[model samples]
Target: MRTTPTAHPNTELLVYGIREIVDVANKIKGLDPALELTWENIGDPVAKGWSVPQFLKEILTEEIHRADNRSFAYTHSRGNIETRKWAVTYAKQFCPSSTLDYEDILFTNGLGSGIAMLYQMVAPGKRILQPSPTYPTHASFESFCSGNAPIFYKLDPEKGWAPDIADIEAQLQNHPDIVGITVINPNNPTGTIYSQETLEAITRLAEKYNVMIISDEIYFRMVFPGHTHVHMAELAHARVPLIVLRGLSKDIPWPGGRCGWLEFHNTDLDPAFKDYCEAVKKRVLLEVCASTLPQMVIPTVYNHPQFNAWNQQYSTELQTVADSIADTLNQIPELTVNKTLGAFYLMPRFKQGSLNNRQTLPITNPQVKAYIEQAVATPNLADDKRFTYYILANTGIVCVPASDFFSPYPGFRLTTLSRNPEERKKTYERFAEATKAYLGSG
Candidate 1:
């Protein structure tokens, strides 16, 4: 039975539409089971062959054996004391300038939750500036809470997706209501790690603008050998306040663990910002605590030497995978590929004029082709999303549309985390074929 809606949704809160993309793919799957579907749309390392390390699994299993009634008890709403302590030590080791105390940290189910709670703390009429092609979770929440489209400083794709300090300055100069700035290190879709120079420049901009910084360093520890991951907390001078968000989702490849934490840095430097952090904690307090078992896993892992070695090994493997995917995608002349340095994803943009409303792929599967033709014909659909649907129905490969990230461009973001190396290569190679065919540029 269906009921008519009595209340209207805040339409402003509807920008994160990746799930619709997934739904479209599933529909295509039913139309053609012969095609193998490769879901590269989102960042889920565990699904891509980056598995829980055997050593960590062993540790988790042993902990389960020792579990008691106390293990199931609710932890502190902010975080378990021991896990927050470990986070303090971890933050200090990497972020040299990070002088985080236990009280400075608060844990959430994952970085997504952390971002939500933080955004809810922002006052109405105030804004948080983010990067275009941002991780949708960050962009959407900030926008949804403020009931406005996200305001962003550009990450110019031409200059290898680096932040244009001049543009950032202009945004701050023009928008007095923007009270905070976001930095996604070793960024999500683009995979461009901000150099130390860029990090320092941004921190200075925040200080000059009197805006706090929100640095999502979820991929901090995953940068390649030559690229350095700077924790904004480390480089954010004491004058500028920041909230550093991190988690084991990428580092430990434990997305299901849903464990992430926030380190409120230099909060004392701005009493108003300190109040905001307290308010976020108060809201989280109602939920009691984040998932507890994952918190327990961390302290135990820290004691094992294999854990450290495992991280380094996993990072090196990702570097190899990222390079391979970039190399493959760049081979297609119609696409502009950026080699990701830190995270396990890369974005490829269609060269200007390569994709337009008139475009159609040579999808021989009649049902698939018909579905796509109907999809692209719909009014107001993003061209990139239409392209993504064609890619899905034609090639059984799914990549997120760039517009989903609030970008002012047409492209798609794909991951290098396919479980099998050979299959991963084949997936992109097939995509290359499908792309070349779709654009008629081969």
Candidate 2:
């Protein structure tokens, strides 16, 4: 008798069960057939009414007209030599003390690809420390690579989502397998920027523990007036090896560019760390190299005078939306909105015990209500179940639950990228109303 074909399986890697913000956005996109879909769920600034500067467009157009770039060609897995040189120069401006070379820069499809490749190079079961309620890519990549959950050092919500250094040290003490620590400056989901004091303290921890430091500085240039960007390399913990990730995705507002690079700092300090980085480089060679067109545009975009003006204007307009959002949400006694320092997302926490299974948003449709009922019955009855669906069914607005962002509290996250100011205010007002109605506060 012929045996049935069996499905083959092997060990799971470090990435598992971690949901992405894009997945959430995609789900919403599928749901709304006719709605305007004020998209705050993802971090694509271009979609938020910010257009590329004219100089950048001209540069990109000129590159597109070049016949030499039309063919598929390969560069060193480390990246193009010229782009690498510029990266070194750009990084040197921030990290003046450290001498960085072109060899220090490794480019990839984007920061996401860079992160995945970097984590994959580490030995199996070796952990990379990450912040909780983090940019899910970091947590998901590490978890996917290790075939186990990535160890998370909590970013305290009460402390404005700042990294808890003491907690990190304690985790490192217990989990000796942790080989590195990662921080997202101008952090995703929560827009808090780390103070120089916090950055220095983290550097000290890395030095003490002899662990590698991986700083994702994708939002380095997105800081508003009160908040300033700080590069991890600038901290210059010489004893601690550093791998700094930066990209054009956020700063240049070019998500489609699919370009970013990692700069090695203190590579000379550890032979083992150097070897791991080499493995990542070899993998990049396997994939050829990052998109050359986007790499070519970097020098022009960063050099253009209009770049700073566009950034400043964008930040100012976003701050206004953030403030409006904060003021609107504050009217509701059941929920609390934190100060948004950077990034495009706002995380609002619902008062503890304020949300229970018994309370729910008023849904007119029986099918939607039944769907939500089944969704909440599972072991996970977090804020997403109530708030996310409530916003969907009642107000026809959708948002991700804060718990989806790995938060322990009962809360939800919303975006301030609505181009229409009046509609934006109305959305938040409706959010406040829906939240109150759900909690029976009215």
Candidate 3:
């Protein structure tokens, strides 16, 4: 007799929405080789034509050619001590009140790996209150660990995508199992840089509820003009246990480098928290260490005279693209467009009742249209996802549905990372035109 293959229960909880859409688009591309897919589904700056700064590249190259180079060997399990020390010193400029030391930093392959490890170490039966419309990795891993759909608090789009504090409090009150709260400042999918007041309010709740705060500050340095990035460590002030996640991927435009670290704050305040940190470190010991090349060049790249200028220019360009895209999308009366103040994404939501199952864009290829029709026919398909599929088939503009962010709203998230002004304008115009046609159809 033959036996069926078995899989772990946790496997079912893992759903990466961005990749899911990308897989569909990949199949469609195979079906139509001529389709020019304009990728807006993911937040890869380099994929959209941005280049890494020359100074940083030079620093890495020099490190690789050095006589004493240890780039090929593993460092300490917690990452290079000198690099961690540099991180501690540099981080202080933003969070003067933080009590983090070199020992508090633990480097991981990337923030994606770091996120998975953090949630995996959570005690069984415990949960984390994640934001709706969250970065999929956070929600997926949190759910995988707990064996349940993630508990969520809303980020109200009507209020500039700010966290609903009262809703957060209510969820904490209602769900005693929620052990931590995750915040993505200059948030993904909806580029909203949280205000200081907002961060403080969240810190207060964490203090009151006695839950640790997981702050994803990967885009900390990417704030556009007229906004400042507020470090969560400053708000916690050694009163609340905090885990601050940072990375070199976005700001450095080095996604391939895959370097990120976790900063633990106020672990001394709780014995259990201290033990938890130790457990995480031990887990890191199993993996040995993160990439050595990126670790060795941290101090040089950050302190380089040209670094600030490069980052400023990058942020300014993103702001221009953001404003232009927002303007174009807003012209469609059926959509609600919020001009992003930080980061490089624009999430345009359809006005309530504007999207219906019956609406779709015209796809010229009959085979592609048939495939999409079959794709959307799945039971309980989200309105935003259906529209996203239609957009992919019709205009070859691939975007992630906002619903994949575990959002309750109907919309889609697209990046403003493309450096070409003319191409960006043309893409958004075509998208806007498709939006109008889709909404008007039903």
Against the true structure, what is every candidate's RMSD?
2.4, 2.9, 1.3
In order, candidate lDDTs are: 0.83, 0.77, 0.90
lDDT of 3 at 246: 92
- Deviation from truth (RMSD, Å), model 2: 2.9
Best by TM-score: 3
lDDT score of residue 209 within candidate 3: 93
Once superposed on the true structure, which residue ranges of model 3 sit more than 4 Å away at CA?
Answer: 1-5
Q: Give the 10-residue window scoring lowest on summed lDDT in candidate 2.
A: 9-18
lDDT of 2 at 236: 60
**Model 1 per-residue lDDT tens digits across residues 156-235:** 99888888899999999999999999998889878899888898999999989899999888887787877777667778
Better of 1 and 3 by TM-score: 3
Task: Summarize candidate 2's per-residue lDDT along 222-325 as a digit string, tens digits.
Answer: 78787788878878646689998889886667898898899888888889888987788777777767777777778778978888888888887778888888
- Residue ranges of candidate 1 with Cα displaced over 4 Å: 1-9
lDDT of 3 by residue, 1-442 (tens): 9989889778978988888888998999999989999998788888888988889878988999999768878888889999999999988998876678999899999999899889888888999999998999999999988999899999999889999999999999999998899999989979998999998999999999999999999988899989988889888977889999998888878888899999988999888788888888878887878999898998898899999999899899889988988898889998898889888888889889988899988888888988999999999999999999998998999899999889899999988876798998899899888888888888
Model 1's number of clashes is 3
- Candidate 3 displacement at residue 139 in angstroms: 0.7
